[model samples]
Target chain A: RMDQGEKKLSSVDRTPLHTEYVKSKLNLEGKDEVRKLKLFMKYIGVYGADARISGFSGYICELLIINMGDFHRTIEAFAAMRGKLVIGDPENTESFDSPAIVIDPTDKTRNAAAAISVENLSRMKLCSRLYLNGKMPEYVQSNGQRKDAKDRGTNLRVFRIKKPDIMDDILYPQVMRFKNAIWEIMERNDLRPVSWEVCVKDHIDVIIESENKAVPALKIHQGPPVDEPSSLDFYNKWINMKISRGPYILGDRIYVDLIRQQKSIGDVVREGLKKVNIGKNIDDQKEAMEIFDPYDTGKDSCALDLFLSKFIFRAHPPEKTSRNTRSS
Target chain B: RMDQGEKKLSSVDRTPLHTEYVKSKLNLEGKDEVRKLKLFMKYIGVYGADARISGFSGYICELLIINMGDFHRTIEAFAAMRGKLVIGDPENTESFDSPAIVIDPTDKTRNAAAAISVENLSRMKLCSRLYLNGKMPEYVQSNGQRKDAKDRGTNLRVFRIKKPDIMDDILYPQVMRFKNAIWEIMERNDLRPVSWEVCVKDHIDVIIESENKAVPALKIHQGPPVDEPSSLDFYNKWINMKISRGPYILGDRIYVDLIRQQKSIGDVVREGLKKVNIGKNIDDQKEAMEIFDPYDTGKDSCALDLFLSKFIFRAHPPEKTSRNTRSS
Candidate 1:
């Protein structure tokens, strides 16, 4: 039957097949955008699993994912809307010069799905496909084209170390010092290490060029804290130094607020705490706050929480609390 | 401060960390024992996944999980073991010329970890500390000579169709016939058409090379059913035969068992199925078995289940199911 209603193919064919081409009659241009994106993704990496977002804002159109072994390969498709070469024309293919960053995707410790965010997707662009031989797949032809087999491998070198010498000398040196400081602060608070060696050093090139001077961007830090060992490490460090005379466990309200403010990396520390662990914990030690109830020692609860609520948590005392105090 | 009580170093020293000294401490000779073995599955010029097993006898280890991404970048330590290398002396650090396969020391996927039985570790012999780039690390440098850059990239290659003449003359012609037979069967059942263009095709190499004449292999299938009026036109013709039905859907359990018995490549079929529109729907087909409560549909369900399970889930079958009940 030449079916138009639902148009679903009702039977399987009995012939030897080579490969299935997606059936499309929409004149090549008009097709389901997601399906087109998927087919393109499959061609680029041969499989797709974790692509998300309705659309993207920058040069990127979508982010696709594939899980191989031990690592998650993320292909950030650049703005297909712009310089995308018309499909089927090998001569017209846009050169994907931007680098693709492969991430751990999910911090196993965190309960989060192994997904990439739109903001991080914007930070990346699909450069070129990396081959196992450390060369780009498209550039290598059997015709003995390039003199050297330099571009044969497909592992995209995401972060190019711009000043390799400078980085080997000054930049990495600074990063090491900063990392040490952060670790020291976390240690005092009895928190676990927040950094993985992979995340800390993958792309020295992109990070060095950006104004966001931190090692990993704040977006990496802005996710849920419960499963984030690194964030918890940082959080514990802040609590020990800033809030005096209490153990530093954050309450549910504070925890929820921190989650809501995930888009802002700075807010986690600024709004969520009373004292900052900017300087050395020992030499710069100064009393951050006086104990709220003199009779109560800080041991009963988290000292950091006590301090954050008093000095950082409240701008104006809750009106209900004030009224209760007045009645008392 | 050689404190003999476990002699812990409380502070890190400023002494330059020598690669030579670090190399000595690594005990490279015994470390290969720590890496594990896995299978590399490739299709459509890309890698699918790695499966680690106990000699294909099908005694699946408990911790087998999928390595999520970057198929080529995986550590090959636990691959088939190589003869022990002469370590400690860099000049004499010779090893048997072998494939680069290893058990990952840190596998994030629970599957790989579980499949790794300690018994398998018994087969491993240690080797030198090669860098992730595949070069011998600095610690193993002989006479201060660094490992070559070309030696650093991991070695794995996806095979390309080197001779199209072989496909044209011998392979694709046979494949086309089998696909037709399968499609006819599927059409008789009102099953959807699997793509002849992309659906799985049996490999000529495996078919000709194996000593046994009945060994079954996998090939690619076209993607799923379409909804547009134009798409249905082509889809109906594609699934017009019984052989095409093999790619579209698996018939009950007995059929799958029969396939498994002949050492048929079920994983290859699943991989092909993943591309079709109905591929994702394969999971739902199990529920359809609920209709045959009194019917001898056990055979049918077994085939469907066998087809549905990927490598990770295939090892252990439920006790109620008989191997004979399933069809391939």
Candidate 2:
């Protein structure tokens, strides 16, 4: 029996405790059936609550199977999910708001599927529908067989950062935070980051794909309207300044063309990283971070594979692969 | 004397009739002062109701002087004018909506300031305020002394089209219509047009200044969201199509990067002109249009001067001339 007035357990601590509670609740016949479904979720890459995976956890899959009866019914239930997916009793599930909600049977206050991101939930539904349609092998078999980085028509920048001596749960979220900060830096500099991915192995590898490698040297700075009181201040500020063009009126607004200090994506990222908060742990080891154009550096095979599978070939199925390769 | 129940006179025919009406209304003493102000208006390049000028006509200037007493008070009245300048009795002026409204003295139904564009009205007010502060010579003397096209940090495209055999009023609007069409073309193709001017001499000279001479070869084309029913259609469409990158999902929306057919501004303009309505008169003579980069062709001195003075030096006063030239 559990202590009545014990403090709430942390997610890491609660997992083992919840497994015991879930095992106690299930009968012998249902236990074997739920175990098979948990393994099935793992096989399809949706069996972790880790920040990197952001999919269904093993315990959540157990709860889903216990409630829905079997693997086929569970897949059918997910395929039919339109908006928010609610499991467990209606009263307990009402408080949780996420892409998928599975009220923890062991601890009613917590959501078992809290870690599932919208993309992952949508991917789960899509995969379930594909599985029902007999197209599962296209997704499962084509995991790491994506085309090379050079084959894709985009400029890729890869950063290899020294991974801090931290646990996987703690390290993964911080790496994701750093990735977001870098994405913002690229966008702020007008580099136009299209897609990005993070792979943590021996080191944290951040791969970003952008539309352009360099921005125009000249940047247009918009100012106040010509009739506004502040327009005089705008004129005074830029009139004597060393600008490329303008302090000229376009329509009603005053604008000046000023020279950008950092034109190349490499230079912009280097300068921008100094100001933005890229997580406390990562910031400490930022000096050890090395930037490379994918062409310059022989990228780690795993990092390249992760980028291609997650981003490049994500929307493509095997039937379309032949056509995509031909056009590309 | 005016005939009753006659058809409405054309602007050209009405000008002489209005001039006679104004002269008869004004006493001999007021006539000399009004005529002097009319000459002043002409000297400052604001004494025409022609489509090219879009400013107060001679008769309008005569009306202003007769109503406001003299040039100094007329300048004072304009300088103090705020939004929607009303120059006649409130009842008749109430019906006309323009930047400036002056109910015609002879024909109460007509707005005498109908031809004056918002820019010209604002220019007249700005000039008046400058004059009030003893800065008239800066505007009057700096007519044709602007710097060369090469010195300015912008890409200039000059088009010398064969001048159509039409009336000045008819031809000027058509030229302006063609200029607008070209501006739209440049904008649609992502060539940012900073400023443009049209000058009609022996040929119709259209000078356009854009941010870049050429756009990137690749262009991003956005499609419907990934969750929408049309996303499958987006996938089907781009899967077979030749594209640079994507049909990839960024955030929620699907996007594809396609190779631009015309990367150069000149090529874009050339192709775009074929599809647009650039006035019936000019369209007939479109084959005679010759494109040039101002550097390749020795630009007409008057056309170059007009581009600089009207666009470049229009915002700058004499005191800032040395500063502007130094920075450039």
Candidate 3:
């Protein structure tokens, strides 16, 4: 041990004077070096009986091996430098009957082999796609072919077919009563359907109108109506029509189910309808709900519209070649 | 329509002249109003057929119904003003549908909910766990609980394990190795174990002394020997004795692993031993590899000690029971 210590110290350029000084202070073979090492260990706060053999290397070892000193002094200096140190026995330290130093031949190579093992595990890559009722606007130039989605805009409407086996012959209209509500706004505001930016942002806006009428579009899909008897009936018709149509609309953005939130649409509509100061007649109430609360008008309407737009316009593309193509 | 418009317009008390102008505009009947709406539709670029029935609310519908010219002008003007807008098109003229609308039901709600309907779907939330091996320090707590990889530290090595049923106890050893590496760093620096931040930044120097010591641990896995054949085969016999007894070492900051990097233990040991100048007639390169490298009498022993420390300390943990624990 003394020889080893001398060799180690000599390697570090410790002058003959310093070497003599340390040698005079502690006899490396007489456990004095161990004592000094222990003191340095305590100062660094990280020590293990077989660390040298066990392959544990840390700051405490550096402080002791390279910067030896009294335990208290070393620790004090470390603390001053904002350095942290800790020492604790592992949970199952007694398991090794053989001192870690008693390394076998296999042990020697295993450590070397372990050094080069690759460990890039536990990562996942997911891919998905989204389809729209109409063609997308972006163009892809693949193999010198330029295809753009803008030209397919006219086919945006999701069509419902009454018969799945034979959908081409019959066409059933999905409920679009919401357009009437939109028309009321146009007429009231004398608002012309011109291309205009809605705010200070750069997002584009598009409007559609007939020669003499304002059409309404579904802003959000709240799934099938729950409380509204008419809505329930309407959905039944819509589904049957869709089944017959052969499911032309298949996209990642399409939600087959609606989530229940704070309240149902019927309740919101009913509350809004009740706020009307018109005559107390039932017809008036019904009309009020239709006109005033058109498109379920409320602070939520704007937000709901935004959601629908995002789903329809901005969603990851799906992987599968939409089954809709097969139906066509 | 005119009377209803007049009644509603009368409620807004602007200047009398403004009111008169509004009244005159409101006097138009259905056909005339529809014409004005059509113009707005053309300017805005929205399909009139879909808009009329898409269920747009009064305000949004008004925007949609604005004349195409006006709509374009609005957007252009808004652009000039550096304004932006996001709008929904039921016809999906943009070939994208709206997905979700995020809004606060009440005013000043920090938490908000997004509305997603069956027709339009968005994203979903998933809950999972992450595992880290090693002793956690006090500082780990002061940091935020939610995981933001950007702020990762070194005291703990984290791994996210989403599926355990499919993965068979692979992470335990890897985590152990990672912890061991960190332990090595702590010891080399002569400082207390610091926060995870230090580990990630590689702030702490990890001194892996000699790769020879890891031989025994690697042998347990029965993996290939280090690339180079050497006299160190004798070490395997010694390592086997420990294997017969059992294999497990536990500690807060220390760890072990059967799996290691690409290089074999034999390869590293051979390399390290060859570099040692243990002079004289030791002809077996294998034996030489096992011997510590002899350095010139002017270099620090810290690097050498740290380099070989791994051979003494690391031990693969017990079977992976808490592999998926968020912070094991």
Predicted structure with the largest DockQ when compared to the true one? 2
Better of 2 and 3 by DockQ: 2
lDDT of 2 by residue, B1-328 (tens): 1347777767777777797888687888777877777665655566678777777877787888878988788888876666666878888888888877988887887888898877666556555655676655534223333355454446888877788788888898889988998899898776778777777767787889886677655577888755565655675677556665544555445577666654787778888888877787788666667788766665442344455555223522222233234323
lDDT of 1 by residue, A51-126 (tens): 3121221112221222211112223223221222122123222222221222211211111112333222221222
Provide the lDDT at B158 for model 1. Answer: 13
Q: Choose 2 or 3, whichever is better by lDDT.
A: 2
Task: Order candidates by DockQ, high to low.
Answer: 2, 3, 1
Question: Docking category for candidate 3?
Answer: incorrect
Between prediction 1 and prediction 3, which has the larger lDDT? 3
Q: Which stretches of candidate 1 lie over 4 Å from their true place?
A: A1-282, A286-328, B1-123, B126-328
> For this target, which candidate reaches the highest TM-score against the unseen true structure?
2
> What are the candidates' C-alpha RMSDs?
32.0, 7.1, 41.4
* Share of reference contacts found in each model: 0.00, 0.06, 0.01
The 10-residue segment with the lowest total lDDT in model 1 chain A: A251-260
DockQ of 2: 0.17
TM-score of chain B of each: 0.16, 0.84, 0.14
With candidate 2 superimposed using the best TM-score fit, by how many Å does residue A59's alpha carbon deviate from the native?
Answer: 5.5
